[model samples]
Target: MQDMLVRLLDLPDVSEEENKLFEKEGVVFKKPITPEKSIVVDWVGEHFSKNWADEALAAFASLPVNCFIAQREQEILGFACFESTAKNFFGPTGVLPHERGKGLGKILLIKSLRALKEMGYNYAVIGGVGPTSYYEKVVSAKIIEKSERGIYKNLLKHSK
Candidate 1:
């Protein structure tokens, strides 16, 4: 997959979406605290991939934690992690299959990109992008040409 670039300065406000999601669906978006680390990481592994769980672990290295989660009641609906695999990189985000189509993914993406902007970055890389059109339409992200492999060019894999 190729990488995409987003102008963090142009991120759309998602506060209303977040509030609506909670008011209507009981889903709340927030950053995870240290106490929730293991649960969050394990959830990511169970629902996504072990590599993503590892990236989620890296997110915990930063103060205040650089991970955002969508939760309803006590269950995690989705998550987005940044500054994990690399600084100023927005990615490794996903929503539960059943929870999609409710704009949760877009909300999570913007929330994470907004975090990067607050950190003084003008643009954020959606490294190893899988949904080119989604990123393009949601945030007006531009494709980074010749970045087919991008930062994951040297990504390690398990031996079969």
Candidate 2:
């Protein structure tokens, strides 16, 4: 695990404004996730379930959904799974129990949304999340429609 400051210092061509953000946030990172790293996913599966692991891995392999983990000391405290479907769509996010309530989840969410925005995804829709939860309340996610939809099935749209 490398410190965020160490990683930030290793970066090159950082602009003055970017440097300020780094100074303010005390961190900066934009590197792609390494598929080989299994620690983060491993913890997720062990704590959540094997089903969650399989789903997360499949989503990572898919084009629209990207899995990202944040490591401040090589220890992934949290992660997010953002998706696209050739159109706007909602995404899913998960945080390790050991790292919750520290605002890390929010950071992970911000990173995921920023990545989606960069990928041209506009609207994000999330469902099946607890109806009365902090996610919907603080994150501004709204429940649009609900019927027989399995929820997860509609996360990423396929080009058929």
Stretches > 4 Å off in candidate 1: 158-160
TM-scores, all candidates, are: 0.96, 0.61
Q: What digit string (tens of lDDT, one per residue) describes model 1 on residues 1-160? A: 9999899987899899889999999998999999999999999988988889999999999988999999999999999999999989987998999999999999999999999999999999999987699988889999999999777998886443
Error of 2 at 39 (Å): 3.0
lDDT of 1: 0.92
Per-residue lDDT of candidate 2, residues 49-147 (tens digit): 555555556555655447665455455555666553222333345666775765655655655656656666555544345443555444555454443
RMSD of each: 1.2, 10.7
Number of the top-ranking candidate, with lDDT as the measure: 1
lDDT score for residue 117 of model 1: 93
Cα displacement (angstroms), candidate 1, residue 102, comes to 0.4
